[model samples]
Target: MHNQIDQAAGLRKLKKNKPVRVIAITSGKGGVGKTNLSVNLGIAMAQKGQRVALLDADMGLANVDILLGLYPKFNLSHVLTGEKKFG
Candidate 1:
């Protein structure tokens, strides 16, 4: 009974979804430091315990992963293809 009650409360919390803030950094030229700014800002926010998702969709400058030096086994591509589940 206690476990079921706890799950019901957790579901309530999830239903009260928080507002999301999306920040995009863009530029038309290279060597303008957009990557550095985005990475640093994301790190600072994460340090403050804020959820941050940095989307580096620019193929020409897809360096967020490289800048953070993170070589993750899975990526957005895997998630999109249903190879992995979010949960």
Candidate 2:
């Protein structure tokens, strides 16, 4: 099991040598599954041994973390408020 995990990790790292593509999906109004699609797509890419980062740019009301069932320690709001950097 450990060996398999190591191999998978190595492959994931190897895949990271290639550039990661970012795709942004936006909607003019709410109720659309933009966050859902973005989260799922990011997860799918990572599962396929690719590097992915999902950023929620909805300043007024961000929902990407909510849709992913994640309670982030900090968000873009913190960065904009000078609490964090662009990690």
Candidate 3:
């Protein structure tokens, strides 16, 4: 399918020998500490000199920025809307 080709092209664009790794922490219940765990884990990894990015995918009710005390001018929505690109 077209999507598969696009995915392959995207992979080909990545630097050789360097692959992307992703981790997801989720729970069925709200207010259970997913955000806290994500923040802490990201910080720990960064402290270890590893590249880390925490995405707040909660859409309308996002709170990771607040929890991290950050004010992001751009987010995934901007990227999805073609207003920005992941560099």
Best by lDDT: 3
For each candidate in turn, the TM-score is 0.63, 0.68, 0.77
Output the worst ten-in-a-row residue range by lDDT, candidate 2. 2-11
Best by TM-score: 3
Per-residue lDDT of candidate 1, residues 1-87 (tens digit): 553323234335544697567688888887799989999999999999998778676645466789999886766565445565442
Alpha-carbon local distance difference test for all models: 0.71, 0.74, 0.77
Write the number of the candidate with greater lDDT, choosing between 1 and 2: 2
TM-score ranking of the models:
3, 2, 1
Model 1 segments more than 4 A misplaced: 1-16, 74-87
Candidate 3 vs. true structure, TM-score: 0.77
Please state the error at residue 37 of candidate 2 in Å: 0.8
lDDT of 2: 0.74
**Predicted candidate 3 versus true structure: per-residue lDDT over 16-46, tens digit per residue:** 5577677998889999999999999999999
Candidate 3: where are CA atoms >4 Å away? Answer: 1-17
Candidate 2 residue lDDT tens string, 1-87: 553323234336645786545577988888788888888888998999887778898888888877778889987777666556553
| Worst 10 contiguous positions by lDDT, candidate 1 | 2-11
Q: Is candidate 1 or candidate 3 better by lDDT?
A: 3
